[model samples]
Target: MSAMTTTPRTVTVRTSAAGFVGGIWHFARREFRDAIASKWFILYTIAFTVLAVGVSFLSLSGVGSHGFAGFGRTAAGLLNLIMLVVPLMALTAGAGSIAGERERGTLLYLLAQPVSRTQLLLGKYLGLAAALVCSLCIGFGVSAVVLAWRADGVGTGSFAMLMSFTAMLALSMLSLGMLISVISRRTGVATGVGLFTWLTLVFVSDLGLMASSIIFKLRVQEIFGLAALNPLQSFKMAVIVNMNASLDVLGPVGAYASQTLGGALPWLLASSLLAWTLAPLGLAMLLFGRRSSV
Candidate 1:
């Protein structure tokens, strides 16, 4: 006291902000790790390898001596295979992301760490998206390489473009899965809902197009525009249109929409895909951050 007391106060500040890119990497890595560790995805990959070998063999048959059907059929078949498998990857990767965290009692611990809610969401999305990319590239790469070993190679560019559109499709699927995980309280419930959602989006969407054709009195142009709002239609449209560039197998309305609203299909597809991915995670973060897990 006589020496004049000196007092010190300790201060701790936690900004917990990683730049956006870092968040993306962090999330992307998490997705890869999760996918690698998951037994189900591993099993699926093995099965996929077997099927890809068979498909590659057939697609590569008589390489240099084929008509248009050979090339077209091979391309179409390969695209179909990609379309089928990629969604499963997306669904399995994302279906359990947040809900499973809650199941494991680590949601609190993760949030309590030096990471903000947004970072958690973005990181997870990025991780999941990266995993999706890996799945697609690996599947596509295997097919491309095997086909190329012969006298004539598959159209790598066409395969790549088709994959690009498929990846975009996966983006929407993954986001929806994540939202289901975040919204649902139980992992099993999330998973069931996720699968159902995937099935409906993938298969039942055509019903929507048919319904529009039957119900609406609108011109062909407006019908396609409205249908484009259905994410699945956009997904297929992106793939088909990009694959052929002039193939409007989608019909006059589809062609018109492509000329008009669907013309920005790339940007719109990206936006919608990202929206589905981000929105659920955003909601998950909000719920998780304030959630009474205690």
Candidate 2:
């Protein structure tokens, strides 16, 4: 009799675990379908494709003696472009995910389900991530085809590395946007805050770092440390280190990071990005889970 009881209990436990995973996936698929049908999705897809193709064409126009731009130069230009665009897209998408649902009266029904808050939030992330990945593939695929046909010196390996960095940057920004969505009760507020955060990180932070370095006469390590704290800067550093032999393009701070970390710089920057991705999402989960109204 005891053996029979234990067998049923084990079976029930396994079933519960499987159901939990299935619920998360169900939400993810639902969200992805919804996103794919939205105007934002169409616009985002077009924006990424146009930007990628434009950058490819523009980068090739200024080739060196070989009459073709190398992967290094093309990768550098694309890195800057991705740094500008991907974060903005991810941030807006993330900011809209939860707060937008709440505003639309769907959050009430969603929370009425059997799914836990953590699972719901993670499912939303997975759905958004899948949508972003699809856009990246479409954009990168078109650009890669154009580059391969028009350019002879492109390095496939480096181009792939740049794509990886772009993904990481998007993930980090998405997490940050999720946190913003969790904090703000309204979609407008979340969107406004996300835009401000993007501006501060992409433009203001660079200016602040430069002023601090020049006026305060900060040390190399200090400047490098400051830059590493910003996810955009970290992504840029990772791409530059992977593509170029020297870090001098970033000036003394880059030189110092290169000399001190050597080959480990890319890994370090990647880790920083990973941290940025996780920390905000974790905080958002904690905050969202605590809300009794949702």
User: How high is the CA lDDT of each candidate model?
Assistant: 0.67, 0.86
Q: Estimate each model's TM-score.
A: 0.80, 0.91
Worst 10 residues of 2 by lDDT: 6-15
Q: List candidate 2 stretches off by more than 4 Å.
A: 1-15, 62-69
Please give, for residues 1-294, the per-residue lDDT of candidate 2 as tens digits.
355544444333333877888878988898888888889888988998998888887777756312234555567668878988899999999999999999998998988977788889998998888888778878888888868766764577877888888888999999999999988889999999999999999999999999999999999999999999999999999988887855778887888999989988989999999999999999999999998786
**lDDT against true structure, model 2:** 0.86
Model 1 agreement with the true structure over 44-133: per-residue lDDT tens digits:
666666677567678657655333334455666666665566676677667788788878888778777766666776678777777667
Clashing pairs in 2: none
How accurate locally is residue 274 in candidate 1, as Cα lDDT from 0 to 100?
Answer: 62
Backbone clashes, each candidate: 3, 0
Candidate number achieving the greatest TM-score relative to the actual structure: 2
Whole-model lDDT for model 1 versus the true structure? 0.67
Give RMSD to native, each candidate: 5.7, 5.8
Winner by lDDT:
2
Backbone clashes, candidate 1: 3
